[model samples]
Target: MIVRCLEIIHPDGDYPVAEFDGIRVGGVYPVLEMVTDDDHCYIRVLGPDSPDPGLEWDPVSFETVDTRIPPGWTLAIAGGRTRLADARWQRPGFWTDYYRGDPQARADYDHVKSELLAAAPPREN
Candidate 1:
């Protein structure tokens, strides 16, 4: 089952999207996404979920985390095997482009994906 990303759209009018590894959220900030067995998700801030400079915590939403978080948002994943903090998830389907940095591997993967797509049956409604 394909789950959806918890797209955090701020009510501050800007509606800035955020990530775990973001400067104001992750990395030095360490605002990590914690997922539960019932498919519930929340944050487990390590030290401080530092709110971004010039941005005040929206009333009735701010948590103890230091980083400026958009209330609660989905951390999209299946089985939680992979991670949202990883850069790879940020650029979906860009693996080919990334491996293009290693010419031989890129060519191999592209050919494989093409062959697989060609062989796979078409989806039906």
Candidate 2:
């Protein structure tokens, strides 16, 4: 999904930080993942650095540009079976690289990616 930032809110603190790094108002971003709790929803998008999914931001700060869910996406409970947060939407292979030491995780990631891609529409030239 794509979103356009509508505002930037800087949290008050004495930690020497002002605003979210690499994020600016009116900036458009592609959402890599989304999570919601009982009160609010958040999204993670690629930052100015590209490739790297930046920090999560409250959904209220942005407006949805594209609501289409890309292929290889799924909704699962965040924090696994321990925490009871709302389900999260994530892209396939999102957790693959995070678990480099776990063979099972890698296999699961590959399987999900393959299955989703096979069922997705062909790319337009």
Candidate 3:
């Protein structure tokens, strides 16, 4: 997914951070994934200098530019072997080792993975 920054609201309390990291108003960013809690949604996107699992930002600050799911992505429920805070849209292989030693969970994961692949759109040559 892609998003464009709509605004930058500064932190109010005595928070350690005082800036929006690398996020800028009007700047477009590629979202790695989105997570939600009881009341708010957070998007994970790369900062100007952060690598890999990037920083999570409030979804209210950005506008959705695209909602297309990338190839090889799958939804992971937060349970069993998964350590996610909530259900997540994640890249393939994100479940590695999480199901280890649990036959039923592993089987369930394999089944879901197969179904996801089968439902994916065909790749262009």
Best by lDDT: 2
Local distance difference test, per candidate? Answer: 0.33, 0.55, 0.54
Error of 1 at 41 (Å): 19
Each candidate's clash count: 7, 0, 0
Candidate 3: global Cα-lDDT? 0.54
What candidate 2 gets wrong by more than 4 Å, as runs, is 12-19, 78-125
Candidate 2 lDDT by residue in tens digits, 1-125 = 66777777774542323236666677676666677767667776544543333567778888987777766565665443212111221434435654554565555544543443344334221
Tens digit of per-residue lDDT, candidate 3, span 73-124: 4555443332222133243454463334455445544454444335434421
lDDT per residue (tens digit) for residues 1-125 in model 1: 11112343454566656642222322222333333445444433322232321122222222332333222223545554333332222234434554446554455444533333343333121
TM-score of each: 0.23, 0.56, 0.53
Candidate 3 error regions (>4 Å): 12-19, 79-125
Models sorted by TM-score, best on top: 2, 3, 1
Which 10-residue window in model 1 sums to the lowest lDDT? 52-61
Model 1 residue pairs with clashes: 6-74, 48-66, 49-65, 49-66, 49-67, 50-66, 50-67
Where does candidate 3 have its weakest 10-residue lDDT segment?
80-89
Better of 1 and 3 by lDDT: 3
Off by over 4 Å in 1: 1-100
RMSD of 2: 7.5
Query: Is candidate 2 or 3 superior in TM-score?
Result: 2
